[model samples]
Target: MNCVKTIVCIAAVMGASANTALAQHTFSMSSEVERVENPLLTNISPGGVTVLRFAPTYAFESRGERYRSRLSLSAVIERTSDTTLLANRDFPSAGYTWGYAWPSSDLELRANLSESATRNTQFADFGRVTVDAREREFLTGARWNKEMTERTRLTLNATNRRVDYDTPLLEDYRELLLSSRVTWDHSETEAYYFEPSHSRLTPLNGGAVSTQTRWLVGTTRALSQEWSLDAFGGQSRVKGAQTETGTLGGVRLNYTGSRLTSGLEWSRDVAPIGAVSRYVRNELLGVRVGYRLTEGTSVAGRYSQSRSTDVATGRGSLFALSLDNQLAARWTSSVGVEERRSSGFGGLSGRGWAVRAGLVYSYASGL
Candidate 1:
């Protein structure tokens, strides 16, 4: 499989580069345990359930004056107490990511390739739960940036992604996206940009292909030393079995302080649902806040709500909070709580809550 091939390739590269003086390697392991009131957030679960998960990762990187390369491999193992729910069974998956960067005085190029597999959670978007489903994805992307002038710059980006499912309930699909942007520095504290992008999604199950095209104008302003704002307005057209045109826009505000960081965002966009092969218009609002209580301890929270503008598509909201503490130089501990609620989407609805605790240990060495 691709996962195995990725592991072998990364191992070979690491062996060949082990003798290099500037190579670095890192390895880390993490374990988490969680208790959920309803594991699947469905009526099928008889009672509360517990889940245990473990992950380990290895990374290698080599850098020079104007170029760099990085490789990473990881695996996940999960087990659950209840066997009734499809998600309750054991899940084992592996993945890898490779990236490269080349930079010069006026131009830069970057590329990345990755493959991963995990349990499908796209059902959560529609207030539904998956039944015996897993998703594997392959992604590749490239970016080019050039300085057109002292105050003007141009960037081009391309990405392709393929998604496959272990179960036939969800159809496999591939997406390709291309985009370009030109940025002008209006002042020391402000910048403006114009962007245009196109995307196509094709399903392997003989479903209608969907395409979207968008044009946008945006600006970024440094409101103050600690505050910044980004706003963009755009128009988008989506075509599939049916064609639709709509206004697309988003706004984001961020604040960075010595001990606190916060952000707020709202956007209207087109997104694809894995359960279905088409695209839907969605409006989303999100807020995140984080505070560093001490040098080694922090607390963060985030909340998001998404609503589909298309009829009967569904709406969902999620809230999560976590506390992280550095227990030692190479060890860390965290505890978190999450709540999710969803409705609509074929008349299915569910609400669930989960509490989790985790610990991580990491080690690094230079070759």
Candidate 2:
């Protein structure tokens, strides 16, 4: 079956079994205006462009003795001063999740389905350059977890994902992945885990299928009430039109206090680039800090740097700062500034800055 059919079937099943004692519904709406310089990070226009965006979301949830289910729908409406730069004006997204637990068997099951579309690539795992195309994705997955002993557990997961672009600049692909993990609680302060997975990626426009196998081991340690650390290392092997093997790992440290929070993270891994129909190894480092200035105000800042192992792929850095304030009982506002610089990537390198301000209104009640 196709992704749409699968998602519909899952939604039907969840709706049919929605006879629960505890149920709730929620709705929220938000609007924002942003002025960005070189919005596309290209030389097309060097002047600032203004953008207005509106977003609204709705969600329904139900819970029984041993099972819970949730469904959500959302949409984005946008207008840009330079319509030629960004074409798509509206985007719709949906998601559904259902989970159940068996106390007698010490087992739990969870399933999720989601669909989304976006024109932003800043957070995309593969793409660093801003493109003029919209990327749409469909994903469905299920997870199973079993408690084998007092201090040991096991988990299994399966997923299917598909990606498509509005333009031919990027290739469309479908991927299937199966993975398993085992965990052991060594002590009250530390836990360790091992995971292995395999995935197959096939291009829709006709090409050889790429397969990847990965093994990872990691541990989480709670150093103190306010400080914690997590570290993981892994190896990946890929086979298809081209073959390669590489090592990947990541580490993170975090701290939390009554009014202060900070974190540092670094990672290196192989990422799939559908545009090129291949994978590249990249490294990333990030630092973030946040402070509560007053009872209803807070400030946060983050810095991130990323570079590919291949010189031709290029590198980039971004610095961002934001301030958030509670304006009323159900209203909040935020203002942010961001600066970015990039080099390489076949003439896709440039520097830019942007400023944004937004307001959000939220309300919730039991149904």
- The numbered model that scores best in TM-score is 2
Assess candidate 2 and give its lDDT.
Answer: 0.77
Tens digit of lDDT per residue, candidate 1, span 65-90?
44455666676677778756435333
Evaluated at residue 146, the lDDT of candidate 1 is 76
Question: Can you give the lDDT of residue 27 in candidate 2?
Answer: 84
Query: Candidate 2 residues 1-367, lDDT tens each?
Result: 2543565467668768667878788888899998878765564556777889899988888888787777776777888888775553676677777878886333333343333333245333432564656666777778888888988889988888877777677788888889999999999999999999998888899888888899999999999999999999999998888788999899999999999999999998876665655556778899999999999999999998887755227677889999999999789899999987766666656777889999998877774
Tell me the lDDT of candidate 1.
0.75
TM-score of each: 0.86, 0.91
Assess candidate 2 and give its TM-score to the true structure.
0.91
* Prediction RMSDs, each to the true structure: 3.4, 2.7
Worst lDDT 10-window in candidate 2: 110-119
TM-score of candidate 1 to 2 decimals: 0.86
